[model samples]
Target: MPLKHRFRTDAALGLVQVSPPLIYALVMLAAPLGTIVLFSFWTQDFLTIDRSFTLNNYREAVTDPLYSELLFRSLRIAGAVTAATVLLAFPIAYFVSFQVRPARKSLWLFLITIPFWTSYLIRVFLWRVILAYDGPVNGTLISLGIIDEPLSWILYNANAVVITLAHAFAPFAILPIFVSLEKIDRSLLEAARDLGESRTATFFRVTLPLAMPGVLAAILIVFIPTIGDYVTPRLVGGSGGTMIANMIQTQFMRLNNAPMGATLAVIAMLSVTLISLVLVLATRRWTRSR
Candidate 1:
C-alpha cells in the first residue's frame, strides 16, 4: 500500500475501534445527562410536565431556602465523611505499605476489601443496627459505665450519617493512599533521616507531600458520592441528617416534580465538580511548590 493510504487505513481502523465506546458513552451517559439538562429547564406542575424551555426550575433550586439548606448540609456531611475516612485511612495504608512484609501485603489488601463481599445496602443497614440506641455500640458503652443510658445522639442524626459514610468509604480512601505509599522510594526517607530530619519531620516533608495525590483521590472518591447518598440518610439519618439527595428523591418520587429533582441533581453535580476542580488545582499547586 502507498504510505498515505496505509495511514488512512490505520486511522479508519482506530475510528472503528473507538466507535463502540463512543456510541456506548452517548447512549449510557450523555443521553441521560442531556435528558436531565433538558428537563431541568422545563417546569413540572403536579402530574403535568411543561415542555417549554424556562429557567423556573433553576430559579427555584437557587432561590429556595430549603434547597440551599439541604445543599449546605450535604456538603458539611460529605466533608466530614471525607476528612474522617482519609485521616483514618492514612495510618492503615502507611502500615500496610511500610510495616507489612511484602508477602503479607496482598493478604492485608484482601482483608481490607472484605467489606466488598457484602451488599452496600446490607452494610448501611448493619451500620444502622450498630449505631442504634439499643444496639451493640450503646450497649457496650452502657456496660462500660461510659454513659447512664443508651445514647440517642449516635443514631438517627447527622452523626450516624457521618459514621456510616466514613466506614463505608474507608476502603476507597485506604487503597489509593496505599498505592501512593507503595510508589514512594524508601531511599528518600533514608536520605531525609540522614539529613537529620526526625521521623515526624521526614513524614511531614517527604512522605505526606508525595502521598498527596492519593489522598486527593481518596477525598474525591469519598466526598463526591457521600454528598448524594440518600439510602443511609433515609435509614439512619432522621430529619436532622437528611441531605440534598433525599430531597431530590422526595421531589421525584413523592412530590411528582421531576424537573425540580433534575434541577437539584444538576446543582449537586455542578457543586461537586467545582469543589473537585478546586481541590485538584490546589493540590497540584501545593505539590509543585513542595
Candidate 2:
C-alpha cells in the first residue's frame, strides 16, 4: 500500500476502535442530559409538552418557600451525613491502612463492603425495622431503662436520616481515606518522629495532612450523593426529614408536573455542581499547599 493510503487505513482503524464508546457516551449520557436541559426550559400541559421556552417553572421553584425549604433541608441533611461519615470513617481507615496486618486487612475490607452487596432499599427498610417502636434499638433502650416509653421520635426524623446515610456511606468515606493514607510515605512519619515530634503532633503535622486528599474524596463521594438522595430520607425521615429529591419525586409522580419537577432537579443539580466544584478546588488547593 502507498504510505498515504497506509496512514489513512490506520486512521480508519483507530476511529473504528473508538467509535463504540463515543457513540455509547452520546446515547447514554449526553443525550439524556441534553433532553433534561431542554425539559427544564420547556413547559408542559397535563399530558403534552407545549415546547415553548419559558422560565415560569424556574421562577416558581426559586420563589416558592416550600421548594426553598426542602432544598435547604436536603443540604443540611446531606452535610450532616457527610460530616458524620467522614468523622467515623477516618479512624477506621487510619487503622486499616496504617496499623493492620496486610493479610487481615483484606478480610476487614471485605467485611466493610458486605453491607453493600445487599439492595439499597433493603438496607433502608432494615433501618426502619431497627429503629421502630418494637425494633432492636428501642427495645435495647427500654431494657436499659433509658426511657419508659419507646421513642417513636428516633424512627422517623432528620437524625435518623443522618445516621442511616452516614452508615450507608461510611465505607465510601473509609476506602478513599485508606487509599490516601496508604499512599503516604512511611519515611515521612519516621522523619517527624526523629525530629522529636510526639504522636499527636506527628499525626497532625504529617499523617492528617497527607490523608486530606482521601478525606476530601470521601466528602465529595458522600456529600454529593447524599444531598440528592431521596430514598433513605423518605423511608426514615417521616415528615421533617423529607428532602428536595422527595419533593422532586412528588412533583413528577404524584402531582404529574414534569416541568416543575425538571425545574427543581435542575436547580438542585446546579446547587450540587457549584458546591462540588468549590470543594474540589479547595481540596486541590489544600493538596497543593502541602
Candidate that scores best on TM-score: 1
Q: How does model 2 fare in lDDT?
A: 0.90
lDDT of each: 0.95, 0.90
Off by over 4 Å in 2: 1-19
lDDT of 2 by residue, 180-261 (tens): 9999999999999999999999998789888898998999999989977899988999999999999989988998788888
Candidate 1 local Cα displacement, residue 262, angstroms: 0.6
Per-model TM-score on C-alpha atoms: 0.95, 0.92
In model 1, state the lDDT of residue 209.
95
Q: Any idea how many clashes model 1 has? A: 0
RMSD of every candidate to native, in Å, equals 1.8, 2.3
Best by lDDT: 1
Name the lDDT of candidate 1.
0.95
Tell me the deviation in Å of residue 132 in model 1: 1.3
